[model samples]
Target: MGEPQNPGRERGLDIILASRAYDLGFMSDWGGAGNIISTLYSAKSTNFASTWAKIETKARTELANELALFRGLE
Candidate 1:
């Protein structure tokens, strides 16, 4: 028995990437500040796309954890 993984981590990474992208310039704070208001004032947000492609984020995070455990995060 153990704690389930926090899927919010994936969204957090997405927000970080999105914040830096050209489509979301106004939405700074690295996703810490969330709202359509903050996100709306963008330079050009017509095609706002996230960099962290879902499964990739999960795989990367899981792989990171496994690697850490192998190196003794166990």
Candidate 2:
């Protein structure tokens, strides 16, 4: 096969981040988790993997369509 792939390179994480961002609300969405933190945080309260998947799906479907249409005009 070709040269061994770099383990550091991440692809699915972006999709997962996209999904989890919507799900976890990234640092920007919903207040970056800083806005919500009680004296005791039971869990990490964020699932970036899922968030990325959700956003990736949406962007691939809706945003992709919009971009395709917009680019065609040019």
Residue-wise C-alpha lDDT for candidate 1, range 20-61, written one tens digit per residue: 745332233223222334344554443334422323455455
Q: What lDDT score is found at residue 2 in candidate 2?
A: 93
Best by TM-score: 2
Give one digit per residue, the lDDT tens place, for model 2 in 1-74. Answer: 79888765577766777776344223333322322343114455575555455455544465556557779999
Error of 1 at 11 (Å): 53
lDDT of each: 0.49, 0.49
Error of 2 at 23 (Å): 20
Models 1 onward score TM values of 0.27, 0.32
Give the distance in Å from residue 35's predicted Cα in candidate 2 to where it truly belongs.
15
Candidate 2 least-lDDT 10 residues: 31-40
